[model samples]
Target chain A: MQTELSGQLGIERAVFGFTPFPAVAAAISRAGGFGVLGAVRYTAPDDLRRDLDWLDAHTGGRPYGLDVVMPAKKVEGVSEADVEAMIPEGHRRFVRDTLAAHGVPELADGEASGWRITGWMEQVARTQLDVALDYPIRLLANALGSPPADVVARAHDRDVLVAALAGSARHARKHQEAGIDIVVAQGYEAGGHTGEIATMVLTPEIVDAVDPLPVLAAGGIGSGRQVAAALTLGAQGVWLGSLWLTTTEADLHSSALTRKLLAAGSGDTVRSRALTGKPARQLRTAWTDAWDDPAGPGTLPMPLQGLLVAEALSRIQKYEAEPLLGTPVGQIVGRMTAERGVQEVLDDLTRGFEEAVDRINRIAGRSGPS
Target chain B: MQTELSGQLGIERAVFGFTPFPAVAAAISRAGGFGVLGAVRYTAPDDLRRDLDWLDAHTGGRPYGLDVVMPAKKVEGVSEADVEAMIPEGHRRFVRDTLAAHGVPELADGEASGWRITGWMEQVARTQLDVALDYPIRLLANALGSPPADVVARAHDRDVLVAALAGSARHARKHQEAGIDIVVAQGYEAGGHTGEIATMVLTPEIVDAVDPLPVLAAGGIGSGRQVAAALTLGAQGVWLGSLWLTTTEADLHSSALTRKLLAAGSGDTVRSRALTGKPARQLRTAWTDAWDDPAGPGTLPMPLQGLLVAEALSRIQKYEAEPLLGTPVGQIVGRMTAERGVQEVLDDLTRGFEEAVDRINRIAGRSGPS
Candidate 1:
């Protein structure tokens, strides 16, 4: 699976591990694969800077990347408070009523509720990008859509590869036109916001649509055999997100959520607009079920939905509300049976890739390498 | 990819081509891959017997299979007319309104509307099974669910293998325990009725759940690379349906529907319950959009939905209603760029499989075959 992307980055493995925790990112980098820190949770620029500082010291100078959530068209002059205020009162009441019915208690007075929508705002993403560029980041990835042309140029000026996650080949072509260095073909089974195309169908199409530009197959990839499959589908490598959620270094902060993810089967996840106002694949819980219910008030869009559910989600997480607890996860959550270190996961992936290669060789009527 | 299932059937390739036309099925068997003719459309036992006779003469003694849509539990004493009576009047009205609005012309007097619920009825399927068993069928596959245990035993008694389509590992396990010889892991991206899991995630889980029982990977598999990937994911072979729809041997009867299918991209399909009572992936047409609209009366459960729309669909196909004419297809319809012979498609698959194997071996740091 080694390709130009891996070669240019000087990464030992073609696997790209996406995580929000600097610890996990550093561990992944140290384990030879590329580590990409998701910058969405880092609402405070200093917090992201601090994490990058920590990563710089812990990564042993191995290459790592940073992923930001920036919408292409800037929603200028919109503050987080303005977005919060735009959320419908009915939606807010529905959130509260649903949580109360579930026996979830409110948070302590003056305690933070984890409601931070600024990270998604283009202005805040620019600030995060400023902080990320100060560090020796090798790749800059956008989660929502293609970043601005100037952002891509700025990254290119610093020799940083610009990458964007796309759910369709049309989106991939747009990213290619926008000068994206790599396209992450995120599928419908992916965690967080996803498109309708599944990885098996999307990867080959994106690869064909954006010829000469490399594509990293994402979603529903948790094992080495899948990595082999992704590469076989014409991907230069694999971009993984959910597999790192259960890693020992991941800072989930809630054992309840971790337990739910660990015990979830592929059938246990549902793509609902309950979270972040976009269709995200997550574990089936009361939260998803309540919002998806036709009788309940429907979810709001994007930033508003994120703001609407933030406090209630915080309360549910704080109280360990068993039935209401869940995090954004892909269908591959079914394969995450245990919590292991990043290095151990990497080892398993390498071994699995070897096994898949041998199996394919035998199936193709060729003798396996001695 | 010569697994025990393929070897037992004397198939030269592990590709299992699924089609409703006996011509396509016989052509597939003649091309060295296994052919499984869908028997749901064979509402009359004599029609199925006639097709089987044709296949026997055309296939040059090569093996072929039959797939029936029979419910696990018999709906005893329920006739097709009884099922039609169960459909709400509003659903019938909605179907009429949708087609009328789309300018789809109605069939003339004495014209058949193509509505036949008997094919799905248990009693009718039993008759089809009786006709199929009398032929030299090597495999008998059930599309809806597991065949009755006695049916499985009957097939086994005559040296026939029973195969069932499963969308989940749990369902695969159920099929395994029901004495099924092969489990077809049909993912969400598949044509017709399907489950929520994508092929990338469902294939491996079902393979693990039904170990030692040969698993065939279905859905979103149109290319040889996907066949290689399926084998790497532990599937014995690939079961393909959508790819056969555009084959020269297929009898679509309408060039408009075939054109719509050939021109579709991966994102051009939707999984909706408008066509049948069950959620089936099909091309996005005015018919699907009308039923999926929130303001509309929405789709009824399977059998009723099929009954309600059969006439309208028949009219659309008969008149070549440009916006309303569509067919059940998978995401792989994106690759159906041209109408070619089954032998050409099979040859391309073999070549693609070899290319994927070579690419994977090279990526694994091994030299390709001499």
Candidate 2:
């Protein structure tokens, strides 16, 4: 089911690729799929602008999208230092002790510092939206909840279709009421922030709850058969994130983390609040294990937890601390054993989709012997 | 794909209904699907024999199966009192306190008391199996791991197919090695004992791991569309448990529990060890919440926990404690909005399956205007 959204946007495949790297996003778009670049990493407007410029030159005129982590309720006038002060001293000490225990040294002088999730703040997302709207972006997707009403109106004025990620049917209904063009029903097996429901149950619920509005099935989807399953569940398309992390065009920055991801299985990932203080499915490492331990001080809420661990995580990455280093991923990681180009992944998805459809047709046509 | 087992067993539909009630099991078989009666509650051999006799008379010559809860490793000579002694005094006190806090009164004199999972003990299971084998049962499924080699050989001697439920491909492979005839890929969203892997990922992985072995997809499966998705993922059939609990034929003594289940959403269940030693999905209630709370004494392992909470759970059920009464249910509980007959559910599944297959074919045939 190439959704109405697909026809309206003039996209080819019913696959939606979500990545943080512009190169990967551009590559997926070129490969006849909709590519959405995650904007949470673009805390600096200049950096996002530079990447969007690259994407504009490299996308071969194919439609591409942008995903911003804009929380619906704005925390007005909250500065970084103000949020930083909210983190407990005990949590600060825990981060330091964890890094020291892992034998991870400090980042080298002049090296880039850790990345903060300050972009999730409403003001920062508004700034990112300002830069994105200036471009020819076809889709503006929100990673958190339904973007603020004014932001949706702004995207609409820029002629960009708006989509939002929802983990439940209740959330999907809210997104639909908030004037979202599409609902991405992200399940428990999804990489980043997710809910308790799995894809098989969540996809159909969201699709039914928000009728007429296109829904993209997310979480636990990596193969063509999965794409077919999504369609059978009434979703118009598939939204993928973890599947693109190992693509050749993507840059995870740490080879050790990359190697670990490649070697990991579906069972190797765990949903823990250790990352960003929200339950995110990620590679289960010593870092996650330490924080998940009952004896350790529990994780802080959202932005606070992200702030507390930012420097420690960067140090682990800088020192190549294999045991402590990890990345957010999903159960589909088991299928991502190799690092292929984005085009190859897209080709496999289409080919698999056809195979699954053919199989189902054959099964449907059969009249069993009485 | 109607597996070789389907033809060999003379089953009509690629649907496996798992229920503890022989009436429901017989009704499912009469409706052209395979029905497997769970033998865990049949602690007495006479009780099981009586049910098997009833199934034989009521099945209308349609073949049915029996599922036993035998652990792979035999715990030699451990009595109920011995296992009860293993539970800590603190845990016992906690159970007492939880029931009292909920104001659950004691069971009336001579009322059927709480059930101990001693049915899971190997010796008890062997007796249950002995009773089951007296009948012409076509399939013998183990709820835990694979049955012992001798048990497999005995079942093989009777020409009964041995199937085992597995949560991961690794466990599925182990079952294959242990002479399992079919593998049930039960995922994280399953009602009873389940693994971390969700059905969407687990079904295909298990299918790939145990190629040529008939695989039944379980967990998060309630609708015909989900059944189609299971087949698309390479499962030979769909194995469902929680879906049957709310059926008209089910005998869940408490109407309060049934009402709660019928009203629950997909988010209303949790994967908690509070029900049993191993993580099992159940309705989220005050009981589960209290057990899951950090302040309360943590749960005891398997039989210990089952033993500690049996009487308290019995008391809650006896008193119809609305807040404390809940049943083991999967995420699919959201779709079970009403109590329906076994035949009606079966018909809906087949019709839905056809609809899903037709939709998939149409989607596959579409060549998008590029």
The top-ranked prediction according to lDDT is 1
lDDT of each: 0.89, 0.88
Q: Which runs of model 1 end up more than 4 angstroms from their true locations?
A: none
Among all candidates shown, the one with the greatest DockQ: 1
Residue pairs with backbone overlap in model 2: B277-B302
Give the TM-score (vs. native) of candidate 1.
0.98
Q: Indicate the residue-level lDDT of A324 in model 2.
A: 88
True-contact fraction in model 1 equals 0.75
TM-score of chain A of 2: 0.97
Each model's TM-score? Answer: 0.98, 0.97
Lowest summed-lDDT stretch of 10 residues in model 1 chain B?
Answer: B112-121
Instruction: Estimate, for each residue in B113-171, the C-alpha lDDT of model 1 and write its tens digit.
Output: 76455577788899999999998889999998888999999999999999999999999
Write one digit per residue (lDDT tens) for candidate 2, span B266-295. Answer: 999988888787889999889999899989
Per-prediction DockQ: 0.78, 0.69
Candidate 2 stretches greater than 4 Å from native: A366-370, B1-4, B366-370
